[model samples]
Target: MEKEFNQFIEKITLTTKQKDEAKTKYTGVCKKVHDYYYDCNYDGSTKFLFGSYKLKTNIRPITKDQDVDVLIKLPQETFEKFNNYQSNGQSALLEEVKSILKEKYTTTDKIKSWGKVILLQFEDSTHNIELLPAFEQDDNSFKIPNTENGGSWEVFNPRAQIDAFNESNKNSDGLTRKICKMVKKWRNFTTSVSIKSCSIQDWAIDFLASNKVDQLEIEEILQKYFEFIRSKCSSDNKSYVETVLKRIEKAINYIDDGEENEASQEFRKIFGNEFPLVEDSSKTNSFDNNIFSTPRPWLEN
Candidate 1:
């Protein structure tokens, strides 16, 4: 089971080629943003990769909708200019960034302002970059635009969050990131599970921090994580949580019965095709016939 878990991790991680492509594209976009704002006190050092990409917990995209988040620190002057606006300065800031990207990606129809970030989608349908233009604060936090409501500036401290995850991951001997990636796979596989990726990572970090996880195998750790997350699930997602708990119980029963192949099939139901079945094992049950067959109400559109 440990060997199978290792294989599953390798299978779900981004390929070297995919990582290279993402770096090339995001760096190019960062360069464009930097060069355009160079005269306005924006330098090459102001841009950075954040989110799952920076944390190294990102999973291989099951769909083309996967994205890379890039933050570009705007000059203080730019912030002051926008902050002085009496109306929706957040919306204005997004539009301005969209126009700047449009200058470089003139032919791509997918470039547009999306809420707080400027989304520059590529033709390959993978690694689309979500560019965030932010103002660096004295305390190293960021003030990013939020176009929703009457428009506002939101304080973001991803660097601190990343540091915390790094500390927890090191202390756990890498179980923090492994469990995060596993949960993300579960999220991608289950259509009705709409939990945010960051929320999943936070849960893993918190769960591992409170428990003695050093002696637990990957399967045992995963079972504990599922149990821990159930309490965190809200009324909105309780049904999905119940389904996951039931399936996890079945998998554990199979493992206890010494039916490793059957256990693998049960796990596959939770984690999707990225999880490997034992050699010569029968095909697993289809998700279409399970409780996940029904789409969440909001996803119907």
Candidate 2:
């Protein structure tokens, strides 16, 4: 896998075409919001990219639900005004955002209210844009409406998260970003692992932020990531962690033996078909012809 890390990175990186499509869709989201708010006699606010896209650590999803998160910050005064007008203030605010998106994207996309965000899913595209309509607070935090729990507001600082990751990336010689992308790639392949995408990002950021990143390589950082989860995970997730950790160890051994083809195959066991396989002259005679063997335990969909 070490020999083919660059290939794996290229495979997982979003292409220019994909990025442009996402940008166009996101522009539509912003435009719809602006149009809605303009009709209401209020100025539409600025939107900030958050989550993996903001950090530039996103990998291509293996599944249909590829998510890109952005935050739309309206004025705090508007939030206060709206809250006073509704019995269920937060729910009303969230629904208002969802309603605008639903109406605007009716022909091309499907909009769903999920947690604090409105999800815009296009009919012919795998990319899912999550719009978190927020109120910009004086403290530089965002007040997001949660329709659940009786329409309460929650404060989130995505800027802080972005800053932390950027700072850590600088010190780690960019290993922090590489590790995050690699783990995301691993998670994309692990079907039975029920961890949320946000959880994965948070866990990776927190782990890498505090780690000693002096001389660690990619696989070593990955091993430590699994070990960190093994230490912190509940009994249910512990089993999955154990399985992944063993496979990682095997891949590392293959790397140590200078068997990168085998190493890539082992890494593929953990990260699925996205891990590329390259022919090696040393293994030309030892290669197996049977390609119909059962998939590795962790590689099953």
Candidate 3:
């Protein structure tokens, strides 16, 4: 079963075309976020970047353009001052971003402002840019309120996650980019149900939690991940994401560990054999069907 899982993981990795596509999107995300950072005065000077975008790929992976997450840092002082803050930092930064986006992306359609924090999404023109404003805590760390997984909310220690990610990356050149490709690769394979594939982190979290896989597996996966990138990705094109997916598919075929099987089954059951939040009629049973699946009047038609 472990071997099967390994095979699946290996198979799900990205391919040259997918890697190139992911890289193109990756570059766009980096540029737009960087521009937003500078535009918002959140550059190195203030409202600093403190997400996967900056760190080496393993710690903070980016799969798609939308996945290149950017969090606007609010120092302890600023975060405390905000009237109300949500665990998702970007929501907090919406309004401030609105004005800047309006000025920069003038031609963009109506950019709505609403939420625990505002959400700014710029699409229809070039690559998309989603800005999330987050407030830093007194200790320079923040946690999301509710997460399904026990570790539902991810912890960010501004300095630590970045430092830890970077320190390890030094051992591997272009580590940040490598993680991004590996993640994109893995995700592209796991959720073959449709184009709205689940993020690699989403799958990984489910797989790891359900199987009770240890950090060693994560690191082992990471090392193998490094080799995959070097062997497959190219200068003109990056097939990393697609190749990784093939590996993941291979892993999925042999994945029969009790916990993993449970998790994967649970994942398919809850996420409709794919990621949730889509309109695919065939794949819309978000709740677990086996666990007293919710009835849909529309489905009766």
Candidate 4:
């Protein structure tokens, strides 16, 4: 079980070389944006890395949805100017950013515009970058443009979210971040859990901060996670939570029966192919029966 869990972590984590390459690519993209804004006389605007990349909870995307989220912080005066010039200034700001990048990358690749962000696709890579144009408010919060719903602005503070994740991870001995990555991998591969990535991080942070569980072992942490899901599903029988609860219960049953191979397979069904497969030949009955038995903590009540 320990070996299988280790393998799962290995598969979910980005390799050192991959991280290095990603840093280089991200830096190049940021530099291009900086150059465009500089030439346009937008001196007070700055760029920030946010979302899963900044939080370090990103997993390998199963589809072509791999991307990094960046925010362009426009100064208060510039924001006011844009707003006063156009009734739908929020969307106008987005267009301004898009046009700047389009000029920079038009010869190389086409930049796709979505409702809230502009996607810059790389020709030879699966990863893309999403640039969000936002206005810096007086309180250091951000009002990002939302092109949907007839165009408007949405408030957000990525710095607060980042700080919450970092502090929670510190309290949990970095298990909060690890669990976030695991949940991302699970969500990427599972069809039942249709929750948003941001919501998933919120749920994981809440669980890590509130739950009192043994943090030394992954198995204990996973058991507590299953328990958390069970609690969330107890009130809704027809929800996706219930669907996932069934799978978690089955995995726990396999563990109780000393069927390591079956248990590993069950976990793979829940977490995806990144989970390691345990062979029948490698099964061992020498594990502490008290640690994994019937009436498991996750299965009780």
Best by lDDT: 1
TM-score of each: 0.87, 0.85, 0.38, 0.79
Candidate 2 regions exceeding 4 Å error are: 38-45, 284-301
Candidate 2, position 165, lDDT: 79
lDDT, candidate 4, at 122: 73
Model 1 stretches with alpha carbons more than 4 Å out = 39-44, 280-301
Candidate 4 local lDDT, residue 196? 63
Position 80, candidate 3: lDDT: 46
Candidate 2: pairs in clash: none
Would you give me the overall lDDT of model 4?
0.71
Candidate 2 global CA lDDT score: 0.75
Each prediction's RMSD to truth: 12.2, 9.2, 18.5, 9.7
lDDT of 4 at 13: 79
lDDT of 4 by residue, 1-301 (tens): 7788778877887777766766666666666666754556434237788888788887764245667778876556666766675467667777777787776676576587778888888775555788877777778788887777667778989889998988988888878877877767776776555556787678778888788865445765765775675555334323655555577667767777878788888788778778888877443543445447646577667
Write model 3 residue lDDT over 1-301, tens digit each, in one string. Answer: 3343333334443445544643454344334444754545322333344444344232212222333344544444443433344354334445555676566445554455544222334453322334445555667675322222321224555577566455544543333344444454444444542222223323333333234223444334543543444433444233444444444444344343323443344323321333222233323344345456666688796
Q: Which ten residues in a row have the lowest lDDT in candidate 3?
A: 144-153
Model 4: which ten-residue window has the lowest total lDDT? Answer: 229-238
